[model samples]
Target: MGKKFLKSDEEVVDPKATLEVSCKPKCVRQLKEYQACTKRIEGDESGHKHCTGQYFDYWHCIDKCTEVQMQSAACSIHCICGFSFALYSLYCMFLLIWSMERSDEEVVDPKATMEVYCKPKCVRQLKDYQACTRRIEGDESGSKHCTGQYFDYWQCIDKCVAPKLFEKLK
Candidate 1:
């Protein structure tokens, strides 16, 4: 008999089917292996002499081809460093000038240098004490220094050489 194709309502089907298939297993393993190997390859090889030589040679070629690019730019690293240093120097100079301009007399310290400077009004006020004493003595002796205009500072007769200037005005 010859093989005959049939159209039927019910077709041959497996009720309890057990099939095993491995598709592209070698490809999956190769992808994982390649990923693992290439992951650290760049970092590990970057420090190597051969890789650094190649890198430096590549940069050197690029630098030679673009000579102007390799030259100092307006915002180059060296220019920035030099500009910052100059700015710092100028700031320090300005600070020194400002400090020098400020007066040093206001600083508070007990151990600092002490010097005597004359003030005229304080000296005149101190001399008034002697004048008051002379006036008091001459008034008793009826001398010309006693014009009787002074009433002996409220008539208590206190000595001017002593500490008490006069009784408090009430």
Candidate 2:
């Protein structure tokens, strides 16, 4: 391989995107219907001609094929991972409560509860970050950035969350 200095900046492609492109061939019929609807309504000045039905039909077809593919694929590899994680966590919590794996004293979500405590302590840092954002709003030149301020705000939150986050996750 040739020496590539900017390899670290390479874009990450989601597996689900590839799956969707593969499933597109199965939905070509719906796709053509949508395309035909648009073509048939191309120059209608009366505004009566519309393709809402065909548009949704195509989307429905794509979603059905995507669902089938998702069932056969690893959910962790999907694009909607955050949503899946949230639902999974809620399910796990429900199961834990039913199985008596977690006691009443154990915090179900420590990071959220801790953030409430952490935020107030870091109000000054938060204000500094907010002020930096406001200052950057007027800078048309791309040289200005609020990265330091952004990091400062997040660093405060992370510090406050760190002490109890691992303990709660356990």
Candidate 3:
């Protein structure tokens, strides 16, 4: 999909540069500390000394800033019933809204429901398949099978159920 599914179709972005630019102002002190630590570690050929602490402090600052921005941008929409989903996860919020103004009914399994409803309509095909099975039972030669009749029965039920199932789901 090579960037086709991205929210933007513009030129490729340098994420590190973007993060640095956005985080530099609020995290300048930590950034300077990290830079200084790097300079100090430059002569350590054994590679035991590191700047992990200062790097994490800088990232913590960026995370705090990003969290505030995400919160501000995320729940800007005020619900008509005067409730806000600022505290809830996005998935729970979606489920709450999607079920609103709809029936308070039990959940259903569409395939099983369609199968029960379609069984009566496909009785003829089922009977035919059963007879084919009986015929195959008498044959010592394993040349005959009830596959055709079984498929016919399945096709009959599917023809009746597929369109209705799609409609109900929609």
Positional deviation of residue 133's Cα in model 3 after best superposition, in angstroms? 0.4
| TM-score attained by model 1 | 0.15
Give, for candidate 2, the lowest lDDT window spanning 10 residues. 99-108
lDDT of 2 by residue, 1-170 (tens): 65455577788778667867866776777799999978865765555446787789777766766655555354333423345577775664455444343222222245656888899989989999889867865554546666688678879999989978887665
Query: Could you give candidate 3's per-residue lDDT for residues 96-153 as a string of tens digits?
Result: 4554423123334577579999999999999999898777555554456666897899
What CA RMSD would candidate 3 show? Answer: 24.8
Provide the lowest-lDDT 10-residue window in model 3. Answer: 99-108
lDDT, candidate 3, residue 67? 51
Q: Which stretches in model 3 have alpha-carbon errors above 4 Å?
A: 1-107
**Cα lDDT over the full model 1:** 0.36
Record all residue pairs in model 2 with backbone atoms less than 3 Å apart, i.e. clashing: none
**Candidates sorted by lDDT, descending order?**
3, 2, 1
The alpha-carbon root-mean-square deviation between model 1 and the true structure, to one decimal in Å, is 45.5
lDDT measured at residue 14 in model 3 versus the true structure, 0 to 100: 61
Candidate 1 structure quality by residue, lDDT tens digits, 66-140: 332223221253444456687655665555455445422233222111101222323444455457645554233
- What lDDT would each prediction earn against the true structure? 0.36, 0.67, 0.67
What C-alpha lDDT does candidate 3 achieve relative to the native structure?
0.67
